[model samples]
Target: MPSIPLPGFQPPESIQEVFLNPGGFHFGTTDTRIVTLLGSCVSITLWHPRLRVGGMCHFMLPSRGVIPEGAGYDGRYGDEAMKLFLGHIMRIGAEPEAFQAKLFGGANMFADMAQRCEINVGERNIEMGLLQLERYGIPLVAKHLGGESHRKLMFDVWSGDVWLKSEQGRKPR
Candidate 1:
């Protein structure tokens, strides 16, 4: 018996989909797509084409310094997230120096956040993303940051591509 191909049907590409919520990350060598929704949060994607491997992280806070009693330390902090990201990259037998990085999210979802809290979490996240990459000597290829709109980001680890879509009528400040 011969199986006939269905009309207008095509096999799906080999892609692993992962959704990174706040305080999460994913690392893989296969063709992977990582998605995240951000409002005053940030996500970073690192890819090493030579090794055909990559990783992504979504973090909500800047650091764990002076964490409240109930707010235990976690990857939700930018500093912690970076440590975890780099650790995993190294564990996977890849050096951080070889990774090409792309940064996304980091929108100031609140207008009065700075005045009230004396800081903008989104901007802080973006800053941490850039600073950490530079500190680790990773090549930051692209970045889409510092906006007032929420962002929906899709990152392709295999190709080192990040697709960013912002909420309607919102612009970077």
Candidate 2:
């Protein structure tokens, strides 16, 4: 049998799809694409343009107090999530300065309640993300934060592109 090459026909790249949950994180090479839905939570994506490797974290709270002995790192808190990201980056022998960061989510799902509460979790989560990025000297190239709607976030490690679709006035089921 003779084979014919068709013009404009190309094989699709094999992508590693990951759906990140609240208090979870994932990091991998160019083949990885991470997706997550956020409401009153924050997600930070770090991508190394040169190495084509990075990760993302979904954190619900700003920080947590004293940790009990033998307690492992929990991504639920923004502080702990940042620590997890740092640990992975360090293990891979990469410096924070080499990566570009993106911030998303931190929506005030309960608008009326937020005004009465002493601490707004959504705002605090955004603050924590900004502070940690500053502390580590990671440049925040893009951000979509502090809204009143939920967001569906998708991050591509290969292209370092982030796609955000806001579910305005509707809560995720």
Top model by lDDT, which number?
2
Report the lDDT tens digits of candidate 2 across residue range 105-131.
Answer: 888888888888766788889999999
| Model 2 stretches astray by more than 4 angstroms | 1-12, 169-173
For 10-81, candidate 1 gives per-residue lDDT tens digits of 223786789988888888755677888888888888888777678888999888687577763477888777
Locate the minimum summed-lDDT window of 10 residues in model 2: 1-10
Candidate 2 at 28: error in angstroms? 0.9
Q: Pairing residues by index, what is the TM-score of model 2? A: 0.88
- TM-scores for candidates 1 onward, in order: 0.82, 0.88
| Model 1 misplacement above 4 A | 1-12, 66-73, 168-170
The alpha-carbon deviation from the true structure for residue 157 of candidate 2, after best TM-score superposition, in angstroms, is 0.6
